[model samples]
Each structure stands twice: as C-alpha cells, then as structure tokens.
Target: MSAGRVAVAALFVVALVLFAAVEIASRREGSRVPSLGDVCGVVMRYRVGPLPVGRIAMFGFWWWLGWHFLAR
Candidate 1:
C-alpha cells in the first residue's frame, strides 16, 4: 500500500483501540464522558477505509450544530 493508506489504516486501528479502551475505562470508572476530540478522532479513523462517510458525518454534525445554534 501507499504511505498515505498505510498511515490511515494505522490511525484507524489506533483510534478504534483507543476508543474502545477509553469507553471501557470510563464505564468502569463511572460518570466520566469522553472528550469530543476522542469521538471525532475515532470517527475519522473509522472512515479511513470507507472513504469519507465518517468524515462527512462528523463534519455534517458539527455544521448542523453550528448552523442551528453556534452561528446564531
């Protein structure tokens, strides 16, 4: 694979592992929520193979929130 694809795959695997680990840790610890960056990073990583669904969903969610609320 190309360097970019390898990097993306590595990132995706890391993100997925981190996301799962963090989520499990949070549940065990009780009452702490993961940060926005963590979630978005996971989504971006997951989309690496799929080509843009994750990215689009992540950005679209932000856009809707900004448009409906923050932009006001």
Candidate 2:
C-alpha cells in the first residue's frame, strides 16, 4: 500500500480507538463524560428563531457527506 493510504488507515484506526475509549468512559457509573447520544440530543434540542437549527444543520451535514462521498 502507498504511504498515504497507510497514514489514512492509521488515522482512522486511531479515531476508532479514541471513540471506543470515550464510549467506555461514558458508560462507567457516575461518569461525568457524556455519550454520543447525549451530545446529539443536546445538539438536536438547540433552536434558532423558531426553527430547529440543529436538526437542519445535521441534515445539511448528512446531505453534504452523502453528496461528496456516496454520490461519486
């Protein structure tokens, strides 16, 4: 494999490890760390001028992600 591909794969592995660590930490009893769902809930509860800005932003992000990555 090319060096660039190796680097990207290493980064992806590192991210997965970090995510797992955070999730495990959040699951501990009385842990102050928030899980992914808690963070998403907070984001989804945000609003702007009677509009659900957080949901809109999330949708936009998914759309953009799909357009750039999946629509190729």
Candidate 3:
C-alpha cells in the first residue's frame, strides 16, 4: 500500500479507537453525554419552513465532500 493510503487507514483506526474511548469514558463517568443527533435536534428546534436550513446545509456539505473525494 502507498504511504498515503496507509496514513489514511491509520487515521481511520485512530478515530475508531477514539470513539470507543469516548463511549467508555462517558459510561464510567456516569454522565449522559449528548450525541450528535441530540445536539442537532437542539440546534434545529426552530421551524425553518418545511425543511430546516441546517439539515440542508449539512447534507449539502456531506454530498459535496463525498463527491469531491470519490470522483477522483
């Protein structure tokens, strides 16, 4: 594998470990850590017509980023 691919894989592994660590630490602390969904729900509590502007912006960014990387 190329160095760049190896680096990406390494970072992916690190992210997985970091996510697991966060879950374990939060459970041990006996504190309720709000998840991404919870935060988004709180942020978009306002009615922005039929669809929320935040959701449109977030999905647009995700779509653009995925296309930019995968279309290469």
Clashes of each: 0, 0, 0
**Is candidate 1 or 3 superior in lDDT?**
1
Ranking by lDDT: 2, 1, 3
lDDT of 1: 0.78
TM-score head-to-head 1 vs 2, winner: 2
lDDT of candidate 1 over 27-67, digit per residue (tens): 65554776656767888776556587788887898899799
Clashing pairs in 3: none
Estimate the TM-score of every prediction.
Answer: 0.42, 0.83, 0.53
lDDT of 3 by residue, 1-72 (tens): 899999998998999898877666556555687655566677666458876777777778889989977989
Error of 1 at 39 (Å): 2.2
The true-versus-predicted C-alpha distance at residue 5 of model 3, in Å, is 1.1
Q: List the residue pairs that clash in candidate 2.
A: none
Which pairs of residues collide in candidate 1?
A: none
Query: How well does candidate 2 score on lDDT at residue 45?
Result: 91
What is the alpha-carbon RMSD of candidate 3 to the true structure?
Answer: 3.7
